[model samples]
Target: MSTCVYVQLRCRPGTTYDVAEAITLKEIHSELYSTSGDFDLLMKLYIPTGEDVGKYINDHLLDVPDIERSLTTLTFKAF
Candidate 1:
């Protein structure tokens, strides 16, 4: 089974758009968007079985410059 994770990202000041664009360029996140909230952006990602979510966060999400913080929620079920 596949796993879906939702990530709320807080971007560095004035870097929201840049960070969103960069994440889009990476093409790893399933869905990404800039939003108006406590968090600057939101992203959804999918990982195959046995894959480490932390590794993907560190290697792909964390690697993006100007990203300040992230909150992740793993989905248990979907309709």
Candidate 2:
């Protein structure tokens, strides 16, 4: 089974669009949403089995610029 994670990103001032564009360019996320509140963007990612979750986030998601903070939610099973 694939591993799924939800990431919420807090972007630097006036940089939400840039950050979201970068993420979209990667073609990695299953879904992305612009949100109101503490986070500027929410992304849903699917990682293939045997991939390292931490490393994937660090290498891909975290590399985007203008991301000031991130919150990751790991999923187990779908009901």
Candidate 3:
């Protein structure tokens, strides 16, 4: 089955727009947007298998510039 991960991203101070643009350029995220609360951005990611989830996050999402922190949530059920 496919795996879905929801990521809460905190961007560096004064860099939200730049970070968002960078994320958009990558085009790896299923959805990405700015938001309030403890995070500046939220990202949805899909992978073909659960095993690739870790690598995908570490190699791709973590590589984005101006990203201060990230919280990843793995989906357990659709409904």
Of the candidates shown, which would achieve the greatest lDDT relative to the real structure?
Answer: 2
Runs in model 2 deviating more than 4 A are none
Clashing pairs in 1: none
lDDT for each residue of candidate 1 in 11-79, tens digit (9 for 90 to 100): 999999899889999888888877888999999999868889888788878999998899999888756
> lDDT of model 1 at residue 44?
94
Per-candidate TM equals: 0.90, 0.94, 0.88
lDDT, candidate 3, equals: 0.88
Q: C-alpha displacement of 20 in model 3, angstroms?
A: 0.8
For model 3, the superposed segments whose C-alpha errors exceed 4 Å read none
Query: What local lDDT score does residue 6 receive in model 3, on the 0 to 100 scale?
Result: 94
- Candidate 2 residue-wise lDDT at 8: 96
Model 1 TM: 0.90
- For all candidates in order, the CA lDDT equals 0.88, 0.95, 0.88
- Candidates ranked, most accurate by TM-score first: 2, 1, 3
Q: Candidate 1: lDDT over CA atoms?
A: 0.88
Clashes of each: 0, 0, 0
* Tens-digit lDDT string for candidate 3 (1-79): 7788899999989999998898889888899888999999999988766567878888887898889899999988858
